[model samples]
Target: MDNYSVKKLSKLAGVSVRTLHLYDKMGLLKPSVRTEARYRLYGEKELLRLQQILFYRELDFPLKEIGAILDDPAFDIVQALEGHKKALLARRERINTLVGTIEKTLVTLKNNTMLQVEDLYEGISPEKVQAWRTEAMAKWGKETVLEAEENLRSFSKEEMDGLKTELNDNITARLTALMHTDPKGPEVQELIARRYQIILRLTGGQIKMEKLEYFRKLGELYVEDNRYTPVNGMPSMELALFIKEATDHYVSEQKK
Candidate 1:
């Protein structure tokens, strides 16, 4: 039977020898054979186990969890591989969409041309946008929602890009930074006030004092919607909640 020494296995597996030793220490993986010289050697069975460990690692499974799963008597290698394939395919689809969005953004930048509404919201699904629009209309009335959408559409590509950049770099950055701070603090409230102004601008200054509640509701939607939870490529439910709290605080202050 063919066997591999620790050094050989490390080279074959593209993992460091120290890593293999650590895995052995952790009882996560162990060589199948120990020679008279106390040298560790891995056989075919150990190779297969190492493959399984790497597969689990690729899926971002915790080392302890992977060890538990692999050591489970009911664990089926074939089923695990099949599940991994499905997850990888889904991840690939999302990556492709983000790539397309980036390409469109690049083209708009290179040509200095206006982007269509769809292009502006490139990676977001039209169905999702429509669903949000429907919900907005139901809550705020058709005229309010349509007017907001029209106002957004009226912007040139450069203006639209600038607005997105400001949201990401200014508003989102500040909100994310203050995630650990008190949401009702002066700094957070100031940021929330700026965010409210930006929203009003997006709505062509249509938002009035009476419609301020809409801004607070919009903050809630940021937490409730998975799409809005990710800002500037980072996902943080905490940040979304922080924004919602700050908006609520801002609105409460307005009432006083």
Candidate 2:
């Protein structure tokens, strides 16, 4: 194993020697060996451990918790990294939502218009909203689910029914007809754009249709959700896969 002096390891790990010394005292990190003069030296394993420490710190994990996690006999580096990746992704998604909310709030401020709470969930029924709330609460706990959202107590049932009618009567029909068309073709892309607009309308500006990743993820949802994928699937999954393909192509083209 390659060994590094405390100073060299500190430089390589981008940590101060004092910090490394502190970690050693806390039993969070121990050097691989000691020199004849009692100087500290680290090995490759110590270097990797220091990296894990930094990663946890970046994610706001407390030093004590980070130390415990790294010292756990059951700890697996890959699993820890995967947890970090998931937490980061969730954080990014929250940031995007906040940014979108800020943009809408800015527009409301500029126009001197009030943003009604009901408008945040336009064209969605109380029943559906409640269903969503139930699912969220089950997964993330009631307080966590409700603390960040406006109380979704009521909504116009008629608006939700109208949107459902439009989806069943108009949108799905149009998508079905275009199933055989090239997803990248002008006609299909146009239809996809129209569908996006309709979603924006129904959402009352809550959904950021402008995000290419959002649309791409929605396409993935259609393929993964059995409600959308009714047939063989992929290019042959009929209207469901057609919408997925068309929306994906639409996003790709928009990037150019």
Top candidate, metric TM-score? 1
Model 1 CA lDDT for position 76: 77
> Candidate 2: what lDDT?
0.59
Worst 10 residues of 1 by lDDT: 233-242
Score every model by TM-score. Answer: 0.35, 0.34
Tens-place lDDT per residue, model 1, 191-250, is 555666555554455556655555555654553352333646321112233334445566
Q: Across residues 1-256, which tens digit of lDDT does each residue of candidate 2 receive?
A: 6479888998998889999999999988899888889899899998999998998888787788798787787768577668878988999999999999998777556333212433334456668656765775675567643433322212233443454456556655666666545544566445444555444433333445465345544644552352332422211011222333445566687789
Candidate 2 TM-score to native: 0.34
lDDT values for all models: 0.65, 0.59
In model 1, how large is the Cα lDDT of residue 127? Answer: 92
- Candidate 1, residue 125: the lDDT equals 75
